[model samples]
Target chain A: MKTSDFRFDPSQVRTGYSHSTIFKEDGFGMNYCSSCGVRVLTQVPEGDHLPRQVCPSCHTIHYSNPKILVGAIPVWERKILLCRRAIAPREGYWTMPSGFMENGETLQMGAARETFEESLARVTIEDLMSVINIAAHNQVHILFRAQMDSPEHGVTLESSEVRFFEEAEIPWADLAFRTVTQALTHFVEDRQRGQRTLHLVDLETTRP
Target chain B: MKTSDFRFDPSQVRTGYSHSTIFKEDGFGMNYCSSCGVRVLTQVPEGDHLPRQVCPSCHTIHYSNPKILVGAIPVWERKILLCRRAIAPREGYWTMPSGFMENGETLQMGAARETFEESLARVTIEDLMSVINIAAHNQVHILFRAQMDSPEHGVTLESSEVRFFEEAEIPWADLAFRTVTQALTHFVEDRQRGQRTLHLVDLETTRP
Candidate 1:
């Protein structure tokens, strides 16, 4: 399935739709108040250092924070599963099954759910692999090492192609995002060292 | 420095202001659209599984996800620093310094910021201690172990009292949040075992 299938209105196309632009627009582009429908003013609320979209009528200060993206690297028979994106922000590039985390779910649950959604593969979420902080884009990517329940996997709406790759066959240059590369690299290195370690990375740039 | 000091209007009081209720209201209590000033309707958008607050006029779907609370367990000379909250939901209860993670900051930066905000102590954030998913409240609490830069510390507006506490002297009964309790327990246990291991906990209930 294409990413446009997820959007309700196709005509309102967002040009240059990178992840940073999408998050910035969704997070800070509040024109009216959600509580009272009044046009909100961009000002610093009392005792607040940062300016927020504050409603003058209802005295409500709307806050926007960084979002978390949960994902997992699924391993089956010593091969890692990857999904080729059917979406934008680097379409057709391979990445571990991941997406924005939903509410009312644990990190493990989100990872497993994203894996199933993208690759059509059921996985048991394992230990935390990497916690990448993309502070510039206001996103935190959390990835886990997962064990595939079975070898059964197929393409889904979010992924046009799904397949397993050995360590030597990983398409290093065609990875979708920097966080994906970081997680996959760490996974490979730790496996070679005969250890499982959690990596915390702070990515300062948007370069992939 | 009561919690009311943070609010602009004290008369608009939230009765029985627990963490779950606060998050529930903040995460799902949308009435009007933020994009357009029209009243939003609760409906499932096309190809969406869950109901969302969707704007009829502008076709903007407001997605609410779980929030991240970044905190630090500050240690100075074999003693842990704790803060007595001056706010509601657990006023006067002891807790490690913590608050909502902000935009444009890494997890370590947020942990240190909250540590200084509540306890007035500058700290160098260390390894991740615990990641507790409070899914029932639509929140995830990430705690880190930190080393104090100096012995200097004081109380802040968020905390009525702040001081160092030995493991035996920690007031277990007066601790504020369950996530805090879990993190502290893990910290003490890991220190005793002479190993630093990250703890991942999924708290199903709101019981403190």
Candidate 2:
């Protein structure tokens, strides 16, 4: 496949969002200190380079790091299981089972959990397929190759529809996010080459 | 090397800290909502599995996800560069140049930036050396193999001392964290075997 096949149109993505805007959407805007309920000041702390939301009363420097998006491409009998997202941020667009990695879980565990949560499919996570850095979105997308325990899966709260698709049946234009498209492409290419190489990509999102 | 060789003693590590304590230390404690400056409630929101610090006034559910600690094992002339941390959490103990990943940077970028910040060395990130999941600590440590730009490096504010060490000269017993020890071991083992492989590990920290 050509590299241009994955070049996302800027108009197709969510507009009017920058890195800081995405950070705020992830519940990271610190107008007030969570520790002392005091108003926070945006300033670089001593020995720190970046400006952080620091509290004057309790002296707490609040930090907001990039979030990890763990996911899995669940395979059963050479077919890939996908879900039509029922949530916003591309509601109706098709995507692999994925979500934010929660605390108290490994990457593999998070991938499996998200798969189950979204598609109602239990998967045995096999290998790391792709690690796509969406720096503009303040997120890293980690996708794993997984084997479905059973071919049984149904619709859930997170997914409007769930079904298995052959390689040719994937909807490239209807994929939820750029990271999803990139991961699925990597998975197909690696499988065709009979390789299990980890795909690392720093995705450059087009800004408006 | 045997698997038992990497088993860490709980007594040798930090004491009296659980996953919740570690979460609070990571600046995730939400006694009050940062958005509305009102007291927050710990409850599972609608259709959510885990209990989050939710704002009743703003209806915002505050999530605390696992954090990523990015680092690099800087390689120069077959020697590995390491730093002696001057800050708390294993002060003065030897560690790879690592810190919490910040916003607007890729994993490789964060690794290179942390290497420069702690050891005053510039590195071209090579490959994915190790990804260790410390679930109890709510952290995923991602270490990369990096090639030093030059042979010049000195002590920085984060590192009290910085130097390159041959394989035999590594201070394994004095390593700061279990994740560091595991990553370094993987690095050495892979180098000796003439292999470039991604090391994925779920470190089971011994609880007191």
Candidate 3:
């Protein structure tokens, strides 16, 4: 496939490496600075092959191999909380309270913060649930099981509406994304089975 | 917090309206382009507010939303099929065989394709196991459970290395990412619990 066949251009990101090679064979070690949007290249040994790129402006090393964090699933009586984007793609469609990991936070902390930010609900994270590797996009998605601290949390304007729906009442047609539908299906089925396995991991030094 | 506090700017990828301010209650209908990543300043009618972005280059209407597909916890008696990257980022790290959905391809097809590509395994995706909403960064991560088609689908250098490890033999120190440990934990617990619930959902989409 031609370089253009790929959706994104690494060169557009300008990480010092070939901003032109389409299918990159090395691990992505550099990245565009979030602050300045400048590409950062990583320091590698003369012969050592690393994928991360370092930013010359801010001096931050970008891992071409970025990782995704697993968050939690908070369920209310037969229903779960979801959000609708105040923005696009599926603006006004339904979604769960989710966001990316913030600096200096654990995966669970990121999940809890997002859940509260979007849903206005404070939840106590229960257990480590699942971790998903979406290699197509080069991300790692993580999941956790959490308990609702309050059932009275109101909805944010970020969501069109926030109400618990029975498994059968899920507005499948109106769901925000495909992942939301799939996740709800799994949650409902697991609840019916009444089997929840609580698992935790030592998060001393999660990926930096 | 100042808008600058946010690291990754959606402005680079989104168009039309200011993502930083669109979330304000008073800032309804402000739009962004799904393609050109331009922030358009427009007022959208309330309630009927439809905020969507269209990509300029690839006529692909950008949906900053999550999608789902299946993944496998493919295992032999004591070993599992893990993938090491031959590409960038965490190039030398290990991962599971997981991928996104394709047109007309069932979830199983996506899972199998990922497995074969990453680990070079020929296995039948057994049943719907778990759904993880790895939407933190953008895409969702889904996981499933499967039985290996053959035990001899030996290691291929397509990845750094493909190997099996007993529960006791898991190389905790050298794993690729956080999700690996999370997935492995869930797999082990499920095996011990007789695989009570075969499915899971990563509700809080954005974590890492």
Candidate 4:
């Protein structure tokens, strides 16, 4: 799917469109009122700053905010973990195991869970290495520097393939997201220097 | 107000309540349906794992997630910036100038905005110092280590008082939130050691 397909309404900020990609993929928002069951209206609520889905009858305002994406940069000596997506949107592309954060879980727990679900790897997570802002999607991507607990990890249903790749073996051209690309690039550079610090950057939404 | 009162629902985790304190305070949720103005129910959707506020009439699932709270540990010389509340919830208590992260703004920008709004201080924000999970409140508090661009920032109507305090002068017992207490404590410890690394900590909600 095109990135534009995922972009939300500017006025609404988080879920900008009356109906957006989220509604298509996650079955969340921009439909019958989650409150009163009437179709929700897109309007700026009184005393509010942005355009929100306001229920006309009960005057309830529905809000959506940027979601957190968590992942790990699993490092074992000189290699990094990589997964080939078996899912749509970016099927066949390689990525660091990552997914939407679940409720009640800390970013650390969510990142570790995604690692297990996608690669079946149990990792000892370390410092957060990256905090990438993907404004177009209203999401923040946080990647942690991690180490493997054992010698082996297997691929699950989410990943058609998985392996540890040397810096030279990274599939730069087939990477899944810009945040992923930026993070891997940082890992390579930091490795060469024998040092690393937090890599903070923003991936602006490419709008026409 | 007690921190327990701020904690939202466990099952309804971001609205953070047995019922949302936000709804009670901001009228954000926990109301009759906004669309139909009818009472909403909490139920697990057809394929979802978590319980959501679903409209019985339309079957729309209202989702809520933890909000990002951004602020700064404004350090200058050997002191830090702090604000005394001029408003309720914790009026008269001391805290780092922090607030809910807003839409369309990066975490750094949002934190800076709060600093300016709370203390009238123009600050050059540096590294994110902490990410404390306040699960009970359905919030993740992100505190940054910051510096003042100039010697002074004005106090606004929101702050009954604004000033810098040495580590000794920090009002430990009278502090506003645990996040504030933890951030301040980190600042003091890091200061004494003459070396500071990112202090990644989770201030868990201690429920009775």
Can you list each candidate's DockQ? 0.27, 0.36, 0.05, 0.16
Best by TM-score: 2
Candidate 3, B51-136: lDDT as tens digits: 43332333333222234444676788758777766766677777777655432233444576567656766666554444443434
Q: Chain A TM-score for each candidate, in the given order? A: 0.87, 0.87, 0.66, 0.84
Kindly list the per-residue Cα lDDT of model 4 for residues A60-158, writing each as its tens digit.
Answer: 676666667889888777689999999897899999988877656666766777787788777777777788876556667888888877647787888
Each model's lDDT comes to 0.81, 0.82, 0.51, 0.70
Regions more than 4 Å wrong, model 4: A1-33, A36-61, B1-63, B75-78
Backbone clash pairs for candidate 1 read A1-A157
Off by over 4 Å in 3: A1-208, B1-18, B21-62, B154-158, B198-208
lDDT of 3 by residue, A1-208 (tens): 0001111122222242343331342233213343344644546523323334545766544333334444456677756766667767788787777765532234455677667666777776655554443433444455666677668666676665666666677777887755565455556666788865422111121121
Q: Tell me the docking grade of candidate 1.
A: acceptable
Q: CAPRI band of model 3? A: incorrect
- Between prediction 1 and prediction 4, the one with superior lDDT is 1
TM-score of each: 0.87, 0.89, 0.43, 0.77
Docking class of 2: acceptable
lDDT of 2 by residue, A93-143 (tens): 999999998777778878878888888888878877798888777899998
Clashing pairs in model 2? none
